[model samples]
Target: MKLAAPIALALSLAASGPRDAETRAWWATTATLSNDAMEGRDTGSPGYDRAARVVAARFAAAGLTPLGAAGGWFQTVPMAERAVTAADLRVGASPLAFLHDYTVNPVGLPARLDAPLAYRGYCGAAALGDVRGRLVICHATRKPGLPGDADRAAALRAGGAAGMIAIADPGFTVEPPRWPFAYARSVRLATQPAPAGGLPQLTLNADALGALIAGSGQDAARLIADGSAGRPLPAFDPPARLTARFAFAERSLASPNILALLPGTDPALADQAIVLTAHLDGYGRGEPVNGDGLYNGTLDDAAYVALLIRLAERRAGRGFRRPVIFAAVTGEEKGLLGSAWLVAHPPVPLGRIAADINLDQLRPIFPLTLLTVHALDDTTLGDDARAVAAAMGVQVQNDPEPERGLLRRSDHWNFLKAGVPAVNFVFGYRPGTQSERIYRQWYRTGYHKPQDDLAQRIDWKAAADFNRFFFALVARVADQDRRPAWKPGSTLAPK
Candidate 1:
C-alpha cells in the first residue's frame, strides 16, 4: 500500500532522533558562522567563502562525517563576475546615448538580452507609444541614494518587455549613488505576452533630471525638473546615441548538507536521521546604505544561525542515540537554491529522513512573548509546535503573512517539496496583533539593506532564548519517536 505524501514525511521524520539537551550547542555552531565580519554571508564573496569554510570545519569537529563526495569538506560553488560598462539606446533606428537617453542600475544577475523597450511610465499610466517587447523605461521620483526601487525593471519585464532600465534622472546624466533597501530593478517575465509591443522600458532619475535639457555637461538634478511630460526639449542637435553593456555571473556550487551521527543504541532506529536546518545566505548589498557597504544582517538571521551552533555544542556527546543532520545551506536568499539542490540530491535517502526543525530568525532574548509556526493548525506539526510553545510559556500563532507566501520561502521549502516532514519556526508579529510590522519593518530597514550590521540595539540574548526553546521543541518531537504530518486534502504542496 502507498502512503499519502504528508503521512510518508511524518513517518520518516518521526524516527530520526531524540536529543533534547544539545540545543545550546546548535546555537554556538551557527553563531560562529554568522560573525559580522562575514558581511551578511553574500554567496560567492570572500566573506561568504570564509563563512562556508567555518561551517565545514565546525561540522568536522562535531564528529559528523562529511557527506560531500570530495575527500575535503568544502564543496566549491562556481560563480562568475562581470563589471558594467556604457549602455546604448536606439528608437526607430535613431541612436540614444547613455547619458543622453537611457540608464541602468541593477543588482548583479545573468541575462541573454538586448530586447526592445517600451516606455511604461508609472506602471503604464503614460502612453507607451509602441514601446512593447523592448527594453522599457520609467521614471523614479525618489532621490538616487534612497531605498525602494528594485521593482521598476521587474514590472517592465512582467509587462512583456524583454528587459528594463530605471532612469533616475529624467534627462540629466549625473551619476547618482546606489540606493539602500532599493527594490530589485530586474523584472520576472509574466506569461502574458505583449500585444504588438515596442521598445523596453527606461526609467529616468527623478532627482537629477533638471540638468538634462541643456544637453551634455549638466547637473543630473536639472533634468528631472525640466523634463515634465507637459514640456518638450530641443530636438537632438546631432541626434542622440545609446549603447549599454550589462554582465553578470552564476554557476553550480556543490554545497553540502552538514550531518552528525548520534548512533542510536537501538539498531533499528539508528538508520533514520533528523534534520535541523537554516539558510546561510542573504541578499547582499553592493551599494552603500546609511554609510555602510555590507548588509551585516546581525539580527535578521545571523542571530538564529548562532542559535543553532550554540545548541549543537550543548548536546555534544549526549542527547539521543539517533543521528542528526545540522544543515546550514547556501543561496537561500536567492530563492532557496542550495536547499532545493540538496533535496534533489540528498546524501541520505529521501525516505530515511525524519522531521525537520527549522530556525529562520530566532529572537527570544528579552521576554519570551510570542512564537510563530509557519504551518500552524495545518496538521499534527502545528499541535506539536504549539505544545512546545505552550510548555515554554510562549504564545503561538499561525503565519500572519500566508498571503505573502512566507510558508514556502526558505530552505524548508525544499524539504516540504520532497515530501519530507518539515516545519519553519519564526516570529512574525506582536502576541495580540495580526499586523506584520516585524517582517515589514525588517524588510524596509535591513532585509537586504547595508544597515543590517550588528549594532547596539540588537538584543543578543534573543538568540540564546531561541536556542533553549528550540532544544525543547526538538526534544518534544525526537524524544517521542512520532511523526507529525500535514492534514489530508491540504493544498499546501510546494509550488
Candidate 2:
C-alpha cells in the first residue's frame, strides 16, 4: 500500500517526554554496543561473548526470565568455522590469487580438487549436457527463461560435475574494485554441517576474468563482448586443465543465542509464545577498506538489538495472553546458524511457537513514512503488522524487490520453514525518491563495513517510531487468543 503523503522532515526532531527518554535510551544502548571495544561483535569471538553478557544483563534488568539452557540467558549453538588460508586456481601456466582474482565459497569446497574445465554457457538444463567429472565453468545469466544460481548449481551437481566455477556476467556493472567485498569466512551449524567433499563452487569477478582465458585459446575480449551483448556464446572446452587447491581448518565453537522470556498473564495462553528476534553478529574481519579493519555493524544490527532491549524494557510489567521470547541470535551473518538451531532445538517446544517477528539490518536513515514487510501476504502475521503499522500512521507495503528474495535471507526464514508464521521489517522507499537514494548509498558504503559505526548519521525520530510500532505489534500478537497461521495456499502453510 502506498503512503497517503510524505511525512514532514520536521517531525524527525520533534521529541516529547517519555518518547524522548526512549530515544535517548535507545541511542545510549546503541553507542555502547557499537563501540569499537565490541570488535564488531563477530560470532564465536570473545567480543560476541561479552555482548551476550550485556544482553543477559539487560534482559534481567527488564524483569525477563532466562529461558536458555541451564536456566541461563545463553543458548549454545554449535558452529564450525572455516577460513581459507590458501586458495589457488591455475589455468595452464597462469596462476590466480585467492581473493584478488577469484574466490571460492568455503562452505561447499574440499581440501583440494584437480579437474579439467568445461564452459557451460549458462549452466541451463539443456546446456549442461555431459559435465560429468569435470569442473564446469558457468556464467551468471539474467536471461528471462533461464534458471537461477541455485537451480544451475543443482543441475550441475545432478549432471555429476566434480565442481562449478561461476563467473559474473560481463554485462553487469562492477563498482570500482570490480568485485566489491572479499569472500566471507563462514560459520555454519555443526549439526547441519558444510559438506567437506561436496560439489565445490567458486565465483570469479568479471573484471579479473582474463586470468581464466589466458593460454586457453579463448579470446578474452570477444567472449566478454559476446556476453555483454547478451548473444549466445558456444559452450566449449577451454584448452586448459584446472588445478584448484584450498587450505582450511574446521574449528568448533559455541555461539550464543540470548533467550529471555516474558510470561503471559493469562494462564491458558501462557503456554504458547510469540518469538521476537534480531541477529547480533556481524562480519568480524576481512580485507580492510580505507585502512579500517573492524565492521562495527551499528546500523546493520547493533541498532536492532538495542531496539529489542528497549522494547523489552517498555514491556516490563505489562500483561499479554501469550509469552514473548526475545532472541538475540548469533551467526546470522554466517547463514542464520543460530536461528536454525533454535528451530531444531527450541527453548519451548517447536509447536508452542505461535509466530516470529524478526528484526535484522533495517535502515532507519530516512523518514518513517513507509515500511516493507517481507512475506507480508504469506501469513496472518502480515495482517497484524499492517494493522499495527497503520495505527502508527505508517503505511505497510510488500517487498518491492522480490527478485532479491529478502524473505529467505534473514533469521525468520528458519522459523517459517519450521511452520511458524513470520515477518521481517525493512524501511521502504519509492522507486524514484530521496529515500531510495539514501538506502542505496548506505548499502554501498556502510552495510557491512566498519563505517556502519555510530559515527554515521541516523534519523532518531524514525528509529523511535519504528521501535514503538514494533513493541505494539509484539503486544498485539502476544495478547491475541488464537495463534497466527500461514494463509491458505501459501507454501509455508502446513498440510
Candidate 3:
C-alpha cells in the first residue's frame, strides 16, 4: 500500500475547494511523512535523505521556485557522524546495565578509564575537596557553579579527576526521554567541530547509582533529598573503585536542507524574504521502548513540515509583498546542524532574510485556546503573533517553562544568532487544568519515544485551528510594511 493514500484522499478533497481542505491536506502530508517507511527520518541517514526528496518534490508541486543548490530544492550540508560501538560500566563488584541502569556519552574523552571513586555532592568545586586522582560521582543540576554535567566534568577534569559519573535525579517519576545508550548515533555540522578536551563522563540512573552507594556510610535517599530541597549535602569517598570503557567510530557525510521561494508581488519588498522553517528529522531507530523502536515523530515536526507545505499552497494565488521561503531543514535533532548551515551559507543573500518563523513539534492534544511562543519577547514578531492569534480567538503567551531554556533549543536560535528576528510556536495549556495533565502525561510517555506516532490521540479541530491561525500569521508578517525587528532592550536585538 502507498504510504500517502490518506494524503491522496486529502488532495482530492482539496481539489473541491472546501473550507477545511487546507487542514485535510496538512494531515495528509503529516501522515505520509510519518509513515513507518520513512524509518523515523534520522538526520544524515538514508531515511532523512528520502524524506528530504519528498519535501522538495512537494515544494516544487506547490509552484514555489527552488532556491537551493544548482536550482534544486536541496541545500546539502556536510555532517560529521559519531556512533558508539561498545560501552560498559562497573562499580564495586556489580556491573551496571546499559540503557535501563546507566547511559554514557564518550564525546570528549578517551575510550577507557579506571580510578578510585568519590561521591562529590553536585560535582561543585567546593564538594570535591582535593580529590585529584579519584573518579567523582555527583548529581546533575541546572544550578550555578555546576550548571550542567559537562560544565561540572570540565571543572573536575581541571582539578585532575580521572572521570565523572552524574547520578540522575531519583525523584523523577517518569524516566526522562533519552536517546538510546549502546546504539546511539549523532551528527553535527562538519564545519563547526566539537570542543577537543574534557574528562570522560557518564550519567547513571538511580538503580546503577544504588550499587555504588550500597556500602558507603552516606545514604543515597538522603543525598537526593538534599539536592531536591536545595540544601547542601556533604561529599564523601565511595566504598568502591570505578571502571569504564567505550569505543566509537567517527565519519563524515552529507545531509539535505529543502528550500522553496514564493516571490513577492511588490517590487520594493521582493528582495527581502521571510523564512518559515521546521526540521524534518527524528530519532529514527533506537533502543526499543514498549516493544517499538522507530521514533515516528508524528508531532515532533512531521505535522509542522506539513504546515509549511500547506502554507506554500495557500498563498499560491495571493499577492503577498515579502517573499516567503519555506525551509524543511534536516539534522535539527542532531544539534540544529541543517539550519546552522543554512544561516552560514544562505541560498539568498544573508542580509535579505528579515525574519524566521520556526515550527517544531507542536501537539494540539487539547483545545487550541493558548499558544506558547518561544523567544516571544525578543522581537516584534511576538506582537504580530498576538494580533493574529487574538483574531483567531487564541491566546498568545510567553514561554511558561522558561527554566527549560527552550528559546535556544530549536532551529530558530540559529537565525537569532545571525541577527535575524525569529520565533518558535507551541500549543500551551493553563495550569491546574485537565489540559495541563494531558500535556504532562504526553511528555512522560510519548515524547521522543516510539509512542509519538499516529496511533496517539489528536484533537483534529485544534490542529486545524492552529493551522488557520499560523497561515494568517505568516501572511501578516509577509505583508506588513515594516520588517520584523528586535524589540529594544532585547539581548537578541541586532546591534
Q: Rate the local accuracy (lDDT) of all candidates.
A: 0.52, 0.79, 0.80
- lDDT tens per residue, model 1, 352-463: 7776777675543344557778766655667887787787677888775553466887777778777776788765456344334444445546555665543323333444
RMSD of each: 12.0, 6.1, 3.2
Order the candidates by lDDT, highest first — what do you get? 3, 2, 1
- Model 1 scores worst on lDDT over the 10 consecutive residues at 186-195
Estimate, for each residue in 44-112, the C-alpha lDDT of model 3 and write its tens digit: 788888888889888887789999999888898998877777767787667877676777664775777
Tens digits of per-residue lDDT for model 2, 1-495: 011111221122223212587777777777666666677888899988888899999999999999999989999999888888877778777787666567777877877788888887778878788888888877775556666788888899899999888876646432112334545476678777466666788877766656665566777677766765567877877667788778887799988899999888888886679899999888766666677777878877888899889988887888578888999999898888889999998998888888999998588899899999988889988999999999888999988776556788899999988888999999998877998888877876777776787667788778889988888888888888667888888866766
Better of 1 and 3 by TM-score: 3
Q: Give the candidates in order of TM-score, highest first.
A: 3, 2, 1
Model 3 lDDT-worst window of ten:
173-182
TM for candidate 3 is: 0.93
C-alpha lDDT of candidate 1 relative to the true structure: 0.52
Backbone clashes in model 3, listed as residue pairs: none
